[model samples]
Target: MNVNKNLLNFLKSQPTSYFAGFNRGIEKEALRIHASGKLATSQHPKGLGSALTHDYITTDYAESLVEFITPVEQNAQTSIQQLLDLHKFAYQNQGEELLWPMSMPCFVGSEDDIEIAKYGTSNIGKMKTLYRQGLKNRYGSYMQAISGVHFNFSFPDSFWQAWASSQGKVANQSSIDEGYLAILRNLKRNLWLLAYLFGASPALCSSFLNGKSTPYPMQKIGKGTLYLPYATALRLSDLGYTNKAQAALNIRYNQLDDYIAGLRHAIRMPSADFASISAKPGDYQQLNQNVLQIENEYYSPVRPKRVTESGEKPTDALERAGIQYIELRALDIDPFNPAGMSVEQVRFLDLLITWCALTDSPDIEREDESIIAENLQQVILYGRKPDLLLEKNSKPIALTQWSTQILAELDDLAKIFDGDTQGVYHQALMAQQAKIENPDLTPSGKIMSHLLEHNLDNGSFGLQLAKQYRNESFERDFHHFTQTQLEQESKDSELRQQSIENADELDFDTFLTQYFGSSLSD
Candidate 1:
């Protein structure tokens, strides 16, 4: 009868069968293209979007891999294991080529293959390689795949504050959007700890442009630059809506336009909050630039928000207001694995989210941008390293201890899920702890170890990719797979358009204005 009781009841009543883990299946079509030496590449100066569409959306690549290879129901498990299977199948069957979009021209294989310049390595290295190659060949980029799974629980609207307070403190704002924003912000902050969770290759490269010899710090982002793939994680909020239907509707009915107006209306005096007012678009751009310039000039290290050319407008500003979900950009589509992810890993991640939801620490604040940046950098560069410092209770604490505690909380959450054994999350946490004990399992260590083991001079990652390109099954399977997917896309698009038509026929605007007193974001 009480709010908290009702909320818990709602959460309990809802099905817990939501997609919790991801499994990717690679289509034979992608493999066939890789097997042939004619994979496409991108050489775009501004960005790679014009160069590679497939590389932009890894989901398409994953779907292609699973085509005809597995039955529809069996393949659609929405678990990380599926993603791994697809990648393993592609790598084993298809020939590996260092193509554009999926990879960058880096020294990847054995230490012996060091003839090539080792520049441009990001979490996005594989994707960049595929795109770059796709540009040159005019065929298509090699694909990196991804599958996403969400563990969602909802409460009745009235009990949001009770739920928030249960986690420790009430939010500054008690609205649904504010609650979502708080959760998302916490997720983003925690993800900064990814490099510590699962190691990535080390950052070892001279200047990307000049190839000048310099000792670069072993951080996610080095001097004058940060990894763009990491940057992409921040951009996840740009898409605006929760689902494709809502996103499409917003785009169609100019819902965002009205929303923007509503926000402006709510701001009683914009001039009071800011230094100046701007009627012209150019003025607004300049004002944004000025803010960023000031922040960079005064601050020692910034989290690298978007920048613009002298004439270009600030495109990523709206996202700062907070209507986005956290995107996991650090995870790569492992070329060696068939599924893009593992079930254990997904379960572990779910546990992490649950911990975030249940933990009652008011450590994060929107105003504390500086601390957020510092925390993110610390995690990416020195995550899980015993010596690295993390701020807790406004004092420095060893990262290892913090991680251990956080992971312990996750272990408890896994018990609450009752889906898999507790061992699943605990194993990963222990493995990570062991790395802190040993320090060799870090991303940098893995990169170096891979090169040494292969006995190659250079291009260890690149060479591994090249091996995947030439697999026989890849060639045969991918060709058929992509064709089928393209056809499927056409059908889906047609169906989507029909749904749009049906929705459009209704007077949603009138219904909302009369019944709800506000227009939906689309």
Candidate 2:
């Protein structure tokens, strides 16, 4: 792949004012654990606000798996501060419970012991819980508990306008959506680079493989830990949150309509396997017998997103307003960072994502999709291996050589990004370059080293880190939001959730019918 010099030059010609207003939001997930290193069997913390209606706090998959969300901000620094404040508020409210610091889960007991997240008595609330139950039935609860970070990003309208002008085209929603889809395609093709650079979950508790055949060769760290020596992110491997049923879907993203059509087809199409689970009125094990319960369930490395209106589905929202932003889902929780990500990491992402958007992105054929997956899998499993190779257009490429090329391109982008303080972007790029040269500097490598040095199992090592974070969180002052504001938000969210419950006019089945009906019509 070669750099698209024309696109790069066009972007470079834009004034620095065009670079303003890069919006970002973060959703960071962490499991709540007990002092004994067991998964916490606790309710959602009261202080953090309602899990369903809160803007900044929620639960994912399980009640104990806490997810902190940040409101969209123009810069990474403010976004990170919001995340830290959320952590502070959550820590204060969660008594005797610590947030598990890694993407891989800590010690888990029997599958039955893991509790599903509960919402109040509204029909929609019941629907949320039932969907999770369905997920538990489809994929085990342990896999659902594996946590990660989602980075939501979008370039400013000014930048898009500049881009359109450069192309001698009108700046319209359709063109913007087309450009974003192109960026999505490019990101999907090159996501393996990110996996190798930032992946942190190379090791996991031995119990994660319980009652199943091991997927790959594993080395024992202690009595209760298993790890791959060169693995970058086991959390992204077949071992975590993977659905074999989805693998056969062959979804495409070259265009918005095609993408929406594929999603609609899957949701409307019935699945015999899920049908067997049951969908009776009171015995609703899942949302429907369809391949997807909701649009959110479709797992992908990246997704185009738009904020939905009242009673609008995610797909409907996208169709209405085009892509407002793209969410990157492949980032693992940075165990070393208290907030799961850093401002420097955010800057690096901004550069890479902008590069992806500005570069030439050809439509990916069905056959080539498998090649992309293979490349990602190779990096996830053996990224640290010096001799490891990755596939580019079905041809072998040295991992280091390809990475060097990317970094060199990034150097040019960095200069364009921060000509005033050239050191800022270059510093981040060099830090990543250091990680490429020295695998020990990588998060997974550091995790492995810590485990070995302390002579602790994965569970023990994670627990220690969680305890350390707990103390640090307590010591740190709130950065962006105050405790009073958090408390008020919690109360307000409770009232909002009740209001939603009160406003429900249709029966659950009737609501589902209307929902899928509108989706299919589109």
- The candidate that wins on lDDT is 2
Candidates in order, TM-scores: namely 0.50, 0.97
Q: Please identify model 1 stretches exceeding 4 Å from their true place.
A: 1-39, 42-174, 204-209, 212-326, 330-340, 361-367, 384-386, 419-437, 442-444, 452-458, 469-486, 490-522
Predicted structure with the largest TM-score when compared to the true one: 2
Question: Taking the candidates one at a time, how many backbone clashes does each contain?
Answer: 96, 0
| Candidates' C-alpha lDDT | 0.35, 0.85
How well is each residue in 1-522 modelled by candidate 1, as lDDT tens digits? Answer: 012343344344434343232222222222122223232221221211111222211222322212212221212334333333333333442233322112122321222211111113221222233222222122111112111222222223333555555545554332444454444445655655554554342332222212333232323332222132211121111110011212211111012233334333332222222334332332321122111211111211102122233212222232333222222334432233333234455555555644544443243443454565566556654553457787765688787677767766555444435545545446655655565565556444554455456543223353455455334334544322353454444356445434434443334333223321222113
Cα lDDT tens digits, model 2, 246-341, are: 878877778899888888888877888887888777788887777888888898879999999976888888888899999999999998888899
Colliding pairs, model 2 = none
Whole-structure CA lDDT of model 1: 0.35
In candidate 1, how many Å is residue 471 off? Answer: 3.0
lDDT for 270 in candidate 1 is 27
Each candidate: RMSD to true structure? 13.5, 1.7
Off by over 4 Å in 2: 2-7, 13-20, 518-522
